[model samples]
Target: MDLDLALVRAFTTTAGTLHFGRAAEELKTSQQALSKRIARLEELLAVRLFVREGGVRLTEAGERFLPAAHEALAAGGRAVAAVSGAGPAVRIDTWGHLYAPMRTVAQAAQALGPVRLEPGPGRDWPSVAQALLHGGTDLGFGRVHPLPGGRDAGLTQRLVRLEPVDAVVGPDHPLAGADALRPADLREYTLWCPAELTRLDFLRRFADAFGIARRQDGPNLGLDHLVQHLRGDAGCFTLFPADAPLPDHAGLRAVPLVEPVPLYAWSLAWRESARHPLLDTLLRGFTETGRAHRWLDYAPRRDWLPDTDHAKLAEGY
Candidate 1:
């Protein structure tokens, strides 16, 4: 009798985790259904793969079968991906046209082969993250880097660059010449935070500190349009990271915010199980950038903030 690929995958996952419940959850299947698959697998092989007493443990035959199982599944996955055009082709998410300054680190991606860097269809961080979780993309660079718990299946977030929040206003605006700003100084102006970016954790946290709320003033709130409004009498202002690329308009200026506003950073995220060379290349670019001195000095690993690759961000991954 031929062994089933599903059974092999279930066996491998259960063996790797040594827990039926976790393996079932990882496989996105029910425990009962998984147990039955295991039973079928043992029946076909005529060898008991697991022994359950207090908890699951692999049998000698199971240990012997593990390598073959992994090889078979990996081969099958490669074949499927090749035919389906889903992998071996790196697809990473980009926000409009924003990506962190990698300090010549992006050049290393050439060693990994072709990359397809594209924007998420929804044009928001949430959509980008959701696409990565559901296998729509291999990696993502976004503003919102929430934790991997809840419905997300173990997505990984790596902070690449530390960027402070900057408020941009027209050259003629009253606050344009302030040189620096504080939370209290922003009370009078209605800040225009795009609906798409309000979900960023640091932005949301800092906005709450100043009682800033989400409001779109006009039809075009993109980086280009927002700057035009700053050059006009829009009676509004917008926030962006210090590292974000702005249009080459002479009348626009991005001012630094003084203490008390939680800072924001650029993050690269991907699935924990996604082990592509392209993903590793991007991770290395962010990790090996040698920018520990630039890390956020204050409570960087705060609980409320999303999972960050602090070790990598601070000490190279």
Candidate 2:
């Protein structure tokens, strides 16, 4: 009869603990199942592995064979790991308020050594697309507008994640305590945005889409400076990605939008001709995580806008 690894593992486990109950618990199986496996192992090997009495005890034969069983399990694990190791390092760039999604990209890069996660150098998608073309970054995660008039580009975009929109209200905002809000709910209140990012068409599109006209503007402090405005009687707010790594300020809150939730996507952007061995591993990690952690929990998939000046952004977000 062939030597059964499962039965051997069970026999060794029971022999080590000298208790079928304890061994079954360690193996995540029933005590009865453990007994069957140990019995089968002993039958195949033609030797009694343990003795059952008032208390369980390993037999002389079991003690002699214990080391071999442990070694067998270790060898199997090593073989699997060796066959699955990643080849080369992948350079990754993380950009925008899209943090939660790009986490998968970082994780994928960990397998490939020398992983670099930097906020890419670019104010918008077109600039980001330029970095890829210049041949410094292997992959970029940010917004990108397709060339106008169906023009050609060297980079490819893959929608990998959805970032749900949320309200970033200050301490004194009237709707701070509301359980949830809609974009139109902010129509009466003043919406604030930084001066530098004003060029992003999505900001204007979002305001116009909801018919909110009383918008205010702030300084170009930084993309991460939105947290500063949420305090000390600011009386205003701006839209934020619900899953972004927002600051834990006492006065700020990212309340979810409802009824007609608006969302933007985070896509993976890579150079068309760029080839690297570890690329597949990074992409596979991005794809698997994207499938499970989408922004829309209730729906099968989130809607992505066209790759336009006001409509671009992505997964591998």
Candidate 3:
């Protein structure tokens, strides 16, 4: 019987990870596609290779077939490499182009051998997560929600930074001349945002915690549009990463938030089953850079973080 290499890869990866979702992510295919390939392979062999009980498990036939499958995949990879000369570049995606994480990614890429960066996937982390799981990108960087056992869906994440945040206000705002403002100081002003408060976890939590009385949402056309809104209303303000570059507008000001400075958490996420060769180097670069620049430093009493983030950091994850 002639076996399809694609089918064999699907089986081997699924077998190795014992998780169809993660296997599909690593193979850069949909789970449905991976399942069909496995079923096709079973049909060709006239054997039930797997048993679906409480979860997926391999039958005796599947256990017996695994070693041969591994060998076949290794041979296929060797065959491809023999003609391809060099492997393909690793692909990376990031969101929040105007934030500090983008700069961190750019700096980390310098340590990689050869890589392809696909930027501006979306404005937030969920978009980046979709790209990772759908095989659109090999890796992604952004804020991450804590998942059970540090794995979510078919992806894994590692905390990379706890960046300090700054408040931006109109030049004519009452607090504009203050050297720095605290969360409580802004309680009387409106927290202007581009999305519904329910959709913005960090900002919503901040408002609730600080007893900020009002929040207003509007279209997020771009930085310029948002700045125009801020400038027109002395009672409105917004937040950005401390290192984010603000435009040179005469009426916009970036004011530091102090007395337990709010921090934005940045993370690197990838498919749990992916085994990219350069992933280690890429992560190491972030680690080394973070250490050199004190990117991960957190002072519990002097800094502010989301409760989940604070717990994760305390656990050293």
Candidate 4:
């Protein structure tokens, strides 16, 4: 028969207690069952392991085996500790549009050690701030918006770039023909928008200025879902980061939102108390990489969109 961990535990406990009754009590088993287990262990080893003299004692052979049994138990403990002692990994959360930044972080982690990238949670500034403040992440990246009173006082924020926001629509939509759309022009069609709570105050201000009221429509959040609806001719229009790649679908087109509020600044943020060396390395890498690529240039002619290349962002870092 194969060796059993339960039998090993029972034998160790019995050896330590030196009394079958006490060992059974500690193990929450009947004395008869505990005796049977010890007997089975002895039979498996083909040796006399214990003797009941006055109370209970290890036999000559059992005395020699006791240390080996303890060594086996210690080995099991070390195995468990080895698995658990690897330390917790760093977590960074970001919106889906910041795939380039995510790739950069991933490359940095690979060169360093284990790390986790959490994505698609923070759709606006408040959500991003809350994620950092609540220990949900070690760092966060997203477009900047008007900070709530007292929010900026406790955190460190860096404006990385000014990204333009554009209205994305399906090819067959009437406004798809326009080279550029003013906020007033958007009121003529139904605007597919994320829920107000998930949207930043600046985006809400832009919508209000453009006279586009929130519509009660199917699937009120999620860019991918909104794009799917647009593809089906659902009379839907949603805003996207100009630096984000246009969905490869033939049915979609992105037109500039010709208002002053159509532009947003991207920022990387962390709590003031966060002082990890890796965090500093990642920040430096991101800043240097962004500068080298001229990612801050938001000119219409610039083609700096997020892509799936880690080596490209890690070029100078």
Candidate that scores best on lDDT:
3
- Superposition TM-score, candidate 4 onto the true structure: 0.54
lDDT by residue (tens digit), candidate 1, 137-202: 667765544444554456767665555667778787788888888766877777665444444445
Pairs in clash, predicted candidate 3: none
> Which residue pairs show collisions in model 1?
170-230
TM-score of 1: 0.58
* Poorly placed runs, candidate 2 (over 4 Å): 1-87, 97-104, 107-121, 147-152, 195-198, 232-234, 295-317
RMSD of 2: 19.6
Q: Which candidate is the best by TM-score?
A: 3
Clashes of 2: 6
Candidate 2 residue-wise lDDT, 36-135, digit = tens:
8988888888898788988888678877666456555545544664587622334556565423445545544455444334444444566556545544
User: How many clashing pairs does model 1 include?
Assistant: 1
Encode model 4's per-residue lDDT on 73-126: one tens digit a residue: 545544664599853344566764422445444433444444334454555567
Candidate 2 displacement at residue 295 in angstroms: 5.3
**TM-scores of all predicted structures:** 0.58, 0.59, 0.70, 0.54
TM-score, prediction 2: 0.59
Flag clash pairs in model 2. Answer: 161-315, 265-314, 266-314, 266-315, 267-314, 267-315
Per-residue alpha-carbon lDDT of model 3 for 276-306, expressed as tens digits?
A: 5567777888787777778888988889988
